[model samples]
Each structure stands twice: as structure tokens, then as C-alpha cells.
Target: MIKGIYVHIPFCHQICSYCDFNKFYFHNQPVDAYLDRLDQEMEHWSRKTDLSEVHTVFLGGGTPTSLSLRQLSKLFDSLEQHFPIHQITEFTSEANPDELTYDKMELMAARGVNRFSIGVQTFDARLLKVLGRTHTEQHVERVIQHANDLKFPSISMDLMYGLPNQTMDHWKDALHRAFQMPITHISAYSLIVEPKTIFYNLMSKGKLPLPAQDLERDMYDYLLTSTKKHDFEQYEISNFAKNGLYSKHNSIYWKNEEYLGLGAGAHGYVDGIRYSNHGPLKKYMSALEEGNLPIIHQNFVTEKEAMEEELFLGLRMNKGVSFSDFKRKYGNDLREIYQSQLSKQIQLGNLEERDGRLQLTYQGRFIGNDVFSEFLL
Candidate 1:
């Protein structure tokens, strides 16, 4: 049973240095063609699954907001034909302020989009231009105000730290500015140089310097403390949400529930099988038009491997994994499976076993991946 759905729109206004997410610099010519294929895929999938059990739906992307109001309206029309639209609890779309205006927000609202996740990487105008962003800080403020005026159920902002040429103070300033807005959620990302990204090439050319290791660590420290100071709770490693506002769609993925992914480069998991659509836009459309699923690869998740995934994905949350859920799923106690590994981590203070549940300690949050890597057979 699929509990969630992810829609990927692989087009962005400008490429960022550290971003490796599947996206291409958007040109207007391909918009209609791409959405046409997306419509076909959604129609096919709607017939493929029952929509009764679906709980949450997310529209993610290179920047979904890049689509024109007309295009977005057509997309919502296609979505309604396939899924239980009113049954969806959370309907989120990733937007950029430059492309998102009052008209676009109102169109999405008219189509029942109740949640928005706008990218506001920083408030510094110079740094924003350096990052190749088209919008100014003022644009973000206006977009947020408009979304709030619509009475959207939730509004989230995305922020990044540890950027090239970013100082500790600059990082704090970004967080400070975002908190000043009426946001119910915040997603923080550390700058990572990814291959083929302009940011990666700049680092390779020595034209930009990454934050020092110690400074990066301190920046993360600042994130944890400042978010806490703002009365936000860190539900996942890089996600903070106000009370009862955690991202339900994302929580489904981390919880390892079966979900469907649509559009180019989107991934889906169902009945222990994991698969992804073709990454290339043209290739994806061609394959689907030929009546194929456009799937590039598929794998079966073994019982043992699914368990390991549970460990890491669950631990990414501050609450960690649940023993009751573990036993119910595997007919095996987690402690019995990873007895030594768990013991070693607990001794190192990276993990804690308390209150009939397991969770990561404070120090564990920083080095969590390291601890998890050891258990990834």
C-alpha cells in the first residue's frame, strides 16, 4: 500500500554550485512537452494504484514554481483526475521566490495546495547573487506574506549553512532572518560540493574556499542551539518544526513506508521493491510514450537490508527507532540483531537506550552518519 507520493519537476532557474539534485537550467521551450509527458504518467499511475490509503502528497523539484500559472493549473487538473485530492493531508510544493508571485500562489491555492516550501537560502543580497539566485531578500518577504495571507496550513523555509565564503556570523544571520518570518518549519542543509555542479568546479578551481572543519562543526552547533532557542524542535537531523508541524510526507519516507514517485528521476518503494524513473527528461518521456514505465533500475529490498535501512533512516530522527515497530515488522528484536554494534555505540555516548525506546544523544547527532556507517553491511 502506498502511503505517499512524490512529484519531481526537474527544472530550475539557475544552477547552484553545491547542488547535485537532478535538474536542468530551465528554458521555456520544453515546459509544455515535459508537462504533457508528466500528465500521461500521472494518468497511468492513477489507474495503477488505489488512492484510498494515501495520506500525504509532496511536489518537489528543481523548482516546481517555475511553471507558469496556466501550466500549474493544468497540473492540478491532471492530479485531481488520478488521486483522492481532498483526502491528502499535506500538499507541499517547492518554490523559489523569483518565480513565485501572488498570481502563482493564488492559482496553487485555488487548486488546493495547502502547504508551501520556499527556498530562502540566505538573506544577504550579495551572497544570494553569488549563489546565482534571481530573487532578492525583499521578494522572499513578500512571497511569505502572501502565503500567510492565503491562510495556508503550513509554510516552510529552506536555509543553507557552510557555504563557500560564508562566515559563522553570516550563517547565523541567515537563520535569524528566516526565523523572523511566519514559518512553521525550517530545513537546513550544509553546503556539500557535488560533482558537475558549478559550486564543485569553483572549489576545484580554488576560486572558493569551503568552511574549515572546526568552523563547519561550530556552524552546525549554532543551528541546533539557535533553532532550539526559537522554540523549534529538531525532528530530523536537518529539520526543525513548530509543534505538530513536522513534514508528514517526509516522515513517511524516513519511516520506510511504501510510496510512489512520479516524474523524471523520482524514486518509488513498494512491496519491498525500490525503483527510479529515468533521469534524463527526454529519455523519460520517450520511454513512457512507448508504453514503458521509464524505470531505469529496480531492486528488491532483502529483509536484512531493510532492517539496516530502518536503523539509519529511523535514527535520523531525534526519537530514533521504535522497538515495538521493529519487532512487529521483523519478528526480531533490534537489540538481538545489532547487539554488539548497539553496545559499542551506547558506550561511546552516540546512542542512548532509555524509556523503553532508543534514541541518539546530543553528541550522537553530529557524528550520527559515522555511527550508522558501521552498521551498514
Candidate 2:
């Protein structure tokens, strides 16, 4: 069953230095045409799947808040037409702190958007400039205040560490400022210099002075400790939430369940086939114009591949993978299939079987990639 719906808004007011997502600048583009095509795509999917079963709908970026009020309304109108917007338990829209105005927030709230995931990479002005972010600390404060005033059920912030010239003290300061906000959740990630990004070019030229590996580790350690102190539970490896306010949409992905991915450059996994849509706006719209799905590439997941994914993706959660759930899903004993790897990790003290759940230990999270790789049969 498709438990979630993820709509991609591939337009950003300003492109960040380290971002490699499929997005374009928001100026002089066919914004209305794109929204129209997006609506067409949703209409097409609605014919094939029962969208009413979808419990969560996530509006991810570029920046969903980059749209004008009218554009947002048009998009919401389409969403309501195809899906039960009010029935969705968690409706989240990713926002840029500078772009999310008071009126926009009101429109989103009226449209049943219960969560705002603001992109506030860092509180430091120098770091914001380095990251190509236009929002200031004050902008973030005002946005949070507005969301609170409107009484949004859940407000979340995305933060990044290990940026160019970032120090331990810088990371600590960002965390402190983040805890001060009236947010229910925080998703913090370390910077990775992906190809085709400004950071990648600078890294190639030795111009990006990133923090050392040890310092990055220390930053992550401090993050785990500090968020716990602030009464936020680490539900996922990088996601912390207060009062059990976990991101239900993201949890669908972690649990390896299927979802419908709409709009240009979106990806979806449905009926054991994982697929991504055409990224170019024209190509995406052209496919829909021809009454076809905009999928560009797809692969049918084999049973072996599914089991591998089950382990790696499920291990990312704090609860880890349930042995019984694995057996029920795959109809094989989890202990027999990856017995050697599980034993190796458990003996190494990186993993443990606690109450039939194979989970990562404190030591394992630091070397998570290395540990997860061992399960690839």
C-alpha cells in the first residue's frame, strides 16, 4: 500500500552551495505551467492508486514556500481534488526561512498543512553566507514565531554541520540556538560535497576548508547529547523530536514502505518497482501531456535485493529491524540469511539483539556505513 505521498517542488529562490537536489532558480521560469503539469501528474496517479489510503503527504523542496500565495493555493486545490487532504495525519511542507511569509503560512495552515520543515542550516551569519543561504537568524525566529501564533501542530528545522571552515564552537552555537526555537523537531545532517555543487568545485580547488573527521564526529556526539538534554528523542539516526512528534512521512521511507512520488524529479517505490520521474520540467510535462507517467527509470526489486534493503534501511532507526517482521515479510529466518554478518557485528560490539530487535549500539552509529555494508549479501 502507498502509505505516503511526496510532492517535489523543484524551484528555489536561491540555490545553496552544497545542495545537489534537482532544483532550478525561481526566476523567469514557467511556474504556472509547472504547477499545471504537477496537477496533471497527480490526476494520473489518482486513477491508478487509492490516494485516500495515504496517511502522510510531504511537500519537499527546492522550497515549497518559494511559490506565491496563488500558486500555493492552486497546488493545494489539486491536492484536495485528488487526495483527502484533511484525512492525512501528517501534512508537511518544506520551507525556506526567508521565503515563508506570514500570509503564506496562513494559506498553508488553512489548506491543512500541519507541519513546517524550515531549512535553517546554521544560525551563524558567516556560515549562512558560506552556505549561500539568504535567511538570517532573525528570519528564522520570526518564522517560528508566526508558526506558533498560527498554532501549527508540528514545526521542524533542518540543520547542517561540518561546513566550510566550521569549528566545534560553531557547531555548539548552532545547536544552542536551535534548541531555543519553538520547534517540535530537528533534522541535523553533516555536509557532503556532492558532484556538480559549488562546494564540490571548491573542494577540488582546495578552497573549501571543512572540519576534520574527528571534529565532525565530535559535533555529532555533542548533537546527540544536547538534543537529549533538551527533551528531544533521537527517533532516527539524524532526526530528533520532542514529545514523540516524529516525522511520520519520513518514517514510511525508513520502514521501507511504498509511496507515491509526484511532480518533476520525484522518486517512488510502488508494487516492488522503484522508479524516478524525468527531472527536466519540459520532459516531465511532455510525458503527462501524452497521458503517460513521467517515470524516467525503474527497476523491479528482487527478493534478495529487498532483503538487503530491509536490513540497511531498517537499521537506520533507533528501534532497528525486528527479526519477526523480517521473517514475516520475506518468509525466511533473519538469523539464517545474514547470520555470519550479524554475528560479526554483534561480536564486534557494534550491534546487539535486544528483545528480538537487531539494533545499532552507540559505537555502531559512528561507523554506521561500515556496519551496514556488511549486510549486503
- TM-score computed on alpha carbons, candidate 1: 0.97
lDDT of 1 by residue, 274-339 (tens): 999998888999987898787899999999999999988898988889999899999999998899
* Model 1, runs deviating above 4 Å: none
lDDT of 2: 0.93
> Candidate 1's C-alpha lDDT?
0.87
- List candidate 2 stretches off by more than 4 Å: none
* Candidate of highest lDDT: 2
Encode model 2's per-residue lDDT on 1-377: one tens digit a residue: 89999999999989999999899999998999999989998888888886657899999978899999999999999999988776799999999999999999999999999999999989999999999999999999999999999999999999999998898899899999988889999999999899999999999998999888999999999999999999999988999999999999999988999999998899999989999999998899899889889999999999999999988889999999999999999999999999899889999999999999999998898888899999887
lDDT for each candidate structure:
0.87, 0.93
Q: Clash pairs of candidate 1?
A: 17-199
